[model samples]
Target chain A: GAGVSQSPRYKVAKRGQDVALRCDPISGHVSLFWYQQALGQGPEFLTYFQNEAQLDKSGLPSDRFFAERPEGSVSTLKIQRTQQEDSAVYLCASSRGATGPEQYFGPGTRLTVT
Target chain B: SQQGEEDPQALSIQEGENATMNCSYKTSINNLQWYRQNSGRGLVHLILIRSNEREKHSGRLRVTLDTSKKSSSLLITASRAADTASYFCATDGRRGSNYQLIWGAGTKLIIKP
Candidate 1:
């Protein structure tokens, strides 16, 4: 793809339900990032991946939040027991090499927990 | 906590007018980047200025950095209606730590045609 892409552009789940969001990064991009953006706020980093290695998972908000990039080029963010506060947009970004480079972002998946 | 603070939370200008946004950060940085977002979805990279460089330009966009003050400014000259969007500033750290790019609240720009 010419740009990074994400699936399930919008999702509405009841509280306590589990949801999964997917991301397809640009081909051969070594760095992938996940961010959580609340209404009227900037993106907050969630986690990072270097190839298949999970180098950083520090920004994840809670134990209920989990992300994986087993194949390196694709990633998934899963949220368990979604809460009302989890209603926000989940964004995915990719960079060619790592750090310092500009990150290409996906359109993001908007999750609304009811 | 966010490292940068974008001043004038919102801005409005005419199509032919210029728009200027400012950003201030707390810590030392190796580089500062500006990005634009429409409807709060994806972000498009606009410009980047290194710590040593004071200014850079791309088309009608001009960026200036003052390392001593830990601040940067973005100027969009001869703006168009399509230029209306939120602008954010991000900084790198620790060997280009991918998720470590500290971001600001952003400035919402409205270009009236």
Candidate 2:
């Protein structure tokens, strides 16, 4: 793709339900990142991947939050037993390198848990 | 915890006027980057300044970094209505030996035409 892309631009889940968001980064990009953004707030880092390796997952808010990039190009973020607090925009970004490079972001998925 | 803090939560100016935003951080960084996000859109990379470099320019965007003070500024010259967007600053640093970026809340810029 010309730029990073994400699936299901919007999602609405009932509290206690599970939701999955997907991201397809630019071709051959070596690094990918996931973030959660609240209304009128900046992105909050969730996790990072160098190729298929999950180098850092410290930012995941809780055990319910999980992300994986098994093939390195496409990634998925899964939230289990979603709560109303989980309502936010889920953003995915990719960079050409593993460190210190500008990242390209996707349009983002707005999740609303009711 | 977010390391970078952007000053002036919101800014409004007439078209053709220059706008500036500031960001401050608490720790050493390898580089700092500015990004712009229009309403309901994703962020686009604006410019980057390395820790060793004091300033950089790209088109109408001018970025300055003061490593000693751990602060950076982004100046947009001759702003246009299309320049209306939220601007954020991110610093590349380590969190307990893990490389990641700390982002500011962002400045909402409105260029009124």
Candidate 3:
């Protein structure tokens, strides 16, 4: 596609349920990132992937949040045992390079844990 | 926090007027970038100003960066109703992770048509 794309634009899950958000970045993008946005706050970094290497996962809130980009082009963010506090918009972005490059974001997946 | 802090959490302006938003950061940054988010969608990159550059322009958007004070400003000239959106300032630390860019709370801009 012309821009980054995310699947399941909106998802509602009960507490303790597991949910997965998918991100398909622009083809050939070398860098991918995952972020979580609360109601009115800015995006907070969750993790980052350079090609297929998961170089930065410090931003992930907890062990419940996991992300992977296996083939270097597509990524998935999985949340296990989702809590009410985990309800937020999951955003994915991709850049052409690993450092100091402009990131293109996707429409985001709004996960509501009821 | 190295993340930038944006002032005027909310802004309302009339069409054809100019809107300016300010952001301040704590530590040194390699570059500052501005992005626009409409409703529930994603953010679109507006402009980027490096630490060494004082100012830059793209269309009606003008961005100014002052590394000495660790501050930056984004000015939108002749605002239009379609320009209504939330604006954010993101900064990449000079010595942090390569892919991490801390973002501010953002300023919600409403352009009255």
lDDT per residue, candidate 2, A1-114, as tens digits? 489999899999999999999999999899999999898888989999999999889999999999999988999999999999999999999988877378899999999999
Tens digits of per-residue lDDT, candidate 3, B49-112, equal 9888999999999999988899999999999999999999998744654468899999999999
Model 1, DockQ value? Answer: 0.60
Better of 1 and 2 by TM-score: 2
Expressed as tens digits, the lDDT of each residue in B1-113 for candidate 2 is: 78889988999999999999999989988889999999667999899888889999999999999999989999999999999999999887565222477789999999999
A1-114 per-residue lDDT for model 1 (tens digits)? 589999999999999999999999999899999989887678888888999888888889899999999988899999999999999999999998866368889999999999
Clashing pairs in 2: none
| lDDT tens readout by residue for model 3, A1-113 | 68999999999999999999999999889999999988778899888899999988988888998999988999999999999999999999999987845899999999999
lDDT of 1 by residue, B21-101 (tens): 999998888889999999745899999898899999999999999999999999999999999999999987545443468
C-alpha lDDT of candidate 1 relative to the true structure: 0.89
DockQ of 3: 0.68
Could you estimate the TM-score for every candidate? Answer: 0.96, 0.97, 0.97
Q: lDDT of all the models against the reference?
A: 0.89, 0.91, 0.90
Better by DockQ, candidate 3 or 2? 3
RMSD to true structure for each model, in Å: 1.5, 1.4, 1.2
Q: Model 1, stretches more than 4 Å misplaced?
A: B94-99
Sorted on lDDT, best first, the list reads 2, 3, 1
**DockQ (Cα-based) for each candidate:** 0.60, 0.62, 0.68
| Sliding window of 10 residues with minimal summed lDDT for model 3 chain B | B92-101
Sort candidate 1 into its docking category. medium
- The Cα error of candidate 3 at residue A8, in Å, is 0.5
